[model samples]
Target: MIKREGYLIKAGLLFFFIFLEILSGRTIFLISSFSFFTTCVLSRQPIRQGRAMKISHQTVVNRIIVVAGLLFSLSEAYAAALLPDKQQKVNQEAINPEYYQGLSPEEAYQWFRDAFSESRKSTELFVLPETEEEISKRATIFNENLQRIIKENAESVSKGESLRLGITAHADLTQEEFQNRYLTLQLPAKRPEVLPELKGLELQQRLSALPDSFDWRDKGVITSPRNQWFCGSCWAFSGTEAVESFHAIHNNMTVTALSVQQVLDCTPKQDGCKGAWPGVVMDYSKTDGICPESCYRHYYSMELSCKKQLIDKCPTHIKVGGYASVPQGDDKALQVTLLKQPVSVSMEASSFWFQFYLTGVFKASHCHTPAKIDHAMLLVGYGRDSHGEAFWLIKNNWGSWWGQKGYVKVQKDKVNTCGISSFAIYPTSI
Candidate 1:
């Protein structure tokens, strides 16, 4: 019979205690990882039958503790190598290069996951790496982007600047691809051949009756933030949200989220996710009205075949006379329209300033060329800035992870900063 002694007694007792703790504790995986099967080491003295003998239980337990400590230290060191020195802070739910430097492959992937929350099913669609080579390439790209942005932002900061850079999800794509994907704005038929400019006197007169401050979002007229994902259906979102707000205010009912998927899928006038004209979207709303988001809420970034059957079972429709054009190049007219309801406006959102706009009323002098009004967004409210400068509060469909939680405030006095006032329009109720 084997008699328990020395190392055996100590190890058995230690394991027994650990077992009890495991029975009564949290994080069983951590505790269980420490656990291992029985093992023996010979004492200085030989055992019975001239063979080496069992270890002292104390020695066994001590050895295990030592090994466990070594493993823990190694784990921490490895993690330190992969992760950033520290998690950097930001105004939004974004991860900038300032947050970390020299991140490993795992860390880079984790960073993307942390900020963008890209699903496992959709991993193949994004720039996530698979092979070892791919991982290295991705890490290099990630760091390059971070360093570039950080350096540029530092220069911007030195100038006593008002805007800052951000590491948006679109940071990975080339500017050309990004523009094509995100800003798919094509003018819809039959509005105007030319948008004439106006003087401030005319603007002041048009906006004379407007309130000093107004925000449809503040008044519960807008929906919660939404993400367009890989889809360029901001046109769909822009028009639908305006319709949503109009229905709420028009019917004197509680504001509810409406479906852009209806317009994305059912409308023949505009392409589904490739891009859409908000004007056509408004026309769709004016004719068919829109389904509530509750009735049909599937916004995979990919476009699908139009489903008229789903439109048949829609929940609510806002009866509208037709789409009304807000005089282009008129901020005051846009403001007047906003005071009553949010307007669907087209703008050139494909600029670096827009991609990384943290806060402050964005100025037009920031960019090189006036980009085409490539994307559409809702002009929800207007108010003076902290310094008494006026700004337009606009809603975005890129989800709350971006800009002021899926919204932006640009300088209002400038008639065409990113072409905000150049292509403004709203739906009129019947």
Candidate 2:
């Protein structure tokens, strides 16, 4: 007895609700069937006296086919939404050892120096040894490792690997020295998704509504990348960067360069050069507020005296209201939080695998497991390649000489690759 118009309106309403429910990560098989049935009912309107509205058998079948096609398309899009594009690709270019093969040991030594042109000018950092024996020893080690690194990349698990084993300030340094300096946090040993019409739809809605990509760098919240040098206080730098980003986002102010020196000089009992927990650094900032870098300079790579007078003397400082730890294994949550501001993060900075990362996403399993977190860096942004591969853009404290301009792209969503998901913490300015 219902009018054809009434049937059409009901069908339309059902379709709308089904759409939202699917977005909330619900299985809409039942809803899909209901929608198809509604369409079928709309198509078979009751016949009138003279003008019989005949819906042939073929027409009903065709309408059902149309509804099925729509449901299938919706299903494809929904799957794409839930299965985030976090895959990584390692470039397969073979190594060019021929360049080094033709050079003599002395020429190779000069080659090393030429490779790092600007570094040699900073003599304090790249000091030439007084003994020729020391110089000869260094050249041998550099050339040996150069070939070894090339061979290792060919067999590495990470695809699209682009590594450069150039002479760094630490080229003459031993393995133990390098490991001691690369400090950061590691992931905890633990590790969900989206809709509007189902249970807990609000949380689901938030997940589905997540933007495909976000970069806090574009928002002017992150400060220029810093260098921790041989100092183990990389954690202090990491925490300070996170605090600055949050302060900028919360207060709508220009990004300020807060002092890692203040954290080093003041955070009681923490070895300034020995490295400390990033959360502990933020805790101190909440209580005492960190001064600007201009006020309390970063001097020694090790812990400095608690220069209470120096901090007290500063006219202005930045403060935060404690810190929050990101869920130990939740990457999507980390990605979501990153959309708001850069986050303070730590992970295993292996001396071997990751020490010479020049370009491309680092997805090596070798860098994931360490005795503990060995270095701290800032999580500034998330990006995807033209091929839909995803990566997390990290800002390191190792000067511009390292990485893609003091930044490295870590693999995203591979169960916390590089310990990125294991230990994440951010401070609040609100």
Candidate 3:
């Protein structure tokens, strides 16, 4: 009876040990430990209470079981330590180019296949709620907005000078009609959360005092208009533009158009092809000098061997800064100032705008709609019509077949309209 009781106690302890191991993600070790423990338990028998007990057999079994469990647990702990942590894995896969670069295309393809297979296997361990309805709603909204954009920007598309595929226009409205309709659209009336307030006189004084010509442009500090393509890398584009302009103004030469591809490929400080903030790019560029267009093309396939050594040209021209903060009612002054120099700006684009060409003049509505604002472009200049209505000179990249040979003029200073205000700027050196 004593021997039998001891065996049962040992079996119970082994079961508990296996349970702990399983809970801690050691499935293989738990299985082995449980099997060994069960065999030890089943092979033992109870001895007569008063008779000499087979103490040696029971003692050896317990010793073997305990030692095996300890060894298995230790091995599991070591393996767990060697495995990459969650954060490490994420960094390795997404941000670390070292892991993916230099591999043959076929090898890279195989790596992705294996990685995705493992990911799918792990995902099956969790239960997810149905997202069908939410997905359907988003699809509907996207389709509706796309159709509206195509219909409204039809004239612009027909002209075929700009990337008019992803933008929208007000249907059946002349530029004047669109402006009038925009004033009545009852959009959100929230005040600008980030701009500084400038009184009217102060704004006028600043505008009047502004130089008629900046030396930066003569130096070649101009940015090429960029198309965001299918990626949301506006933040990268903005940062690159600011830096390129700064280089042009200070160096007393034409602003050398820098490669956005360099920022997209090299800067690990922020999201790559996905959306990133301008501030992050600014910070990263300070330490890592800009790369030339020949070395780094916009697409990965265009990347050439980095034969040109990197140059450490920190921004020495304009005061290095981030985004601009213009007051709510100061759109006119801001536009006037921006017209003096090229500016990089962000806007919400409709899907249809991606397919059509935009020409003539457009009165933009304030960006309060549900559409995601993922596009960025350069503001080349602005002008006023005989009727005293303002228009913005904008450059776009969908080649030279769209808009007015590759540009569009948008309405300026109308509340809740596009081109109401501009964003970041790099002043040209006097």
Candidate 4:
């Protein structure tokens, strides 16, 4: 009877041990090993040594307790390994235009506010309206842009155009406000008497086997686009990018950023935040030489005065020997120049279609002419889309969140779409 009672207690303890192992969420092998070990120990006890067996049973119980404690620690360590570190943060999802598809205007507005406004706490690109009146006004503007997006998509479908438009970061902004704040490229009041014309047998020799598609980015001559914020410093961004590409191409090195801030601060006759011409930015590089970004950091909201201290401290990596034009409105020349290096081009980007462009070959109905070019962008490459429509691949300085990852593909046109082929120029690196 004593041995029977001992066996029952041992059996119960083994069952409890197996139960705890199951609860621990360990592997099948571990559970089986534990069960086998408990069964072996309990079954190995002699029924002849009755009192001694009872004492052994108590010892087994103590051993089981110790094993359970170790298992608990192991399980906890395993779980901790699987969990993400508290210090490691997950990145926010990239903005997706498709999320708004098929939703009503009201629903779309709610979605936009949830996505952008909530993120604004950390991003600072957006701000919640402080007043009820301001909230109402912003909602109205957002809905207006939503309507434009719908109409634009419908037109693309009806016309069988490859272009697409969607709600962008600027969805709530009015065309006038977007233009005034973002489109700050100030063209010269009149054309220069003698435009610096780039001509050489070497350039002609390099143009012989122009590929059907060419991208300086693929060749590792272009850097990621930088955002200009509300500053009209597109001229400096575009010119600096061109110089970087020129230096990389000539020196067989990867492209890196020179200071757009240096150009904005030191370039003569150019308003820092209001606007500057791309030509003057390039000219500044040739004469004064722009420093690396580490030397003069860019502050998009406000332009600081040129500091002699920064110039004295940071050395300029490369200087432009000079710059030359591609003859305004010459698409063919622009393509040929792109074969040699990325070129800086001025364009009109004030239209709502241009401002909210998402992807595909962007062809707008009311795009401005060459004379009305109000924005400067880097012309990086040219290629045809899957639909056989040719496009000029240009990089915008509006940050990675805008456009197709800080780039836009404008339709290639003999008439110079958006004045892209207009005012195109490239720097000659020294």
- Strongest candidate by TM-score: 4
Order the numbered candidates by TM-score, best leading.
4, 1, 2, 3
Q: How does model 2 score by TM-score?
A: 0.67
lDDT of 1 at 121: 28
Better of 1 and 4 by TM-score: 4
TM-score of candidate 4 against the unseen true structure: 0.72
Count clashing residue pairs per candidate.
6, 20, 31, 0
Candidate 1 lDDT by residue in tens digits, 266-371: 7775677678778777778777777777666456566667666766777566556667776667666666667778888888777767776656667676644554
Point out the higher-scoring one by lDDT: 3 or 4: 4
Q: Which pairs, if any, clash in model 4?
A: none
lDDT of 4 by residue, 327-392 (tens): 667676677778878988988888877887777888745575434689999999898989898889
Q: Rate the local accuracy (lDDT) of all candidates.
A: 0.66, 0.65, 0.47, 0.71
Cα-based TM-score, every candidate: 0.71, 0.67, 0.46, 0.72
What lDDT score is found at residue 180 in candidate 2?
65
Model 4: residues >4 Å from true position, as ranges? 1-98, 101-110, 117-128, 190-208, 369-371
lDDT (0-100) at residue 265 of candidate 3? 66
Model 3 scores what on Cα lDDT? Answer: 0.47
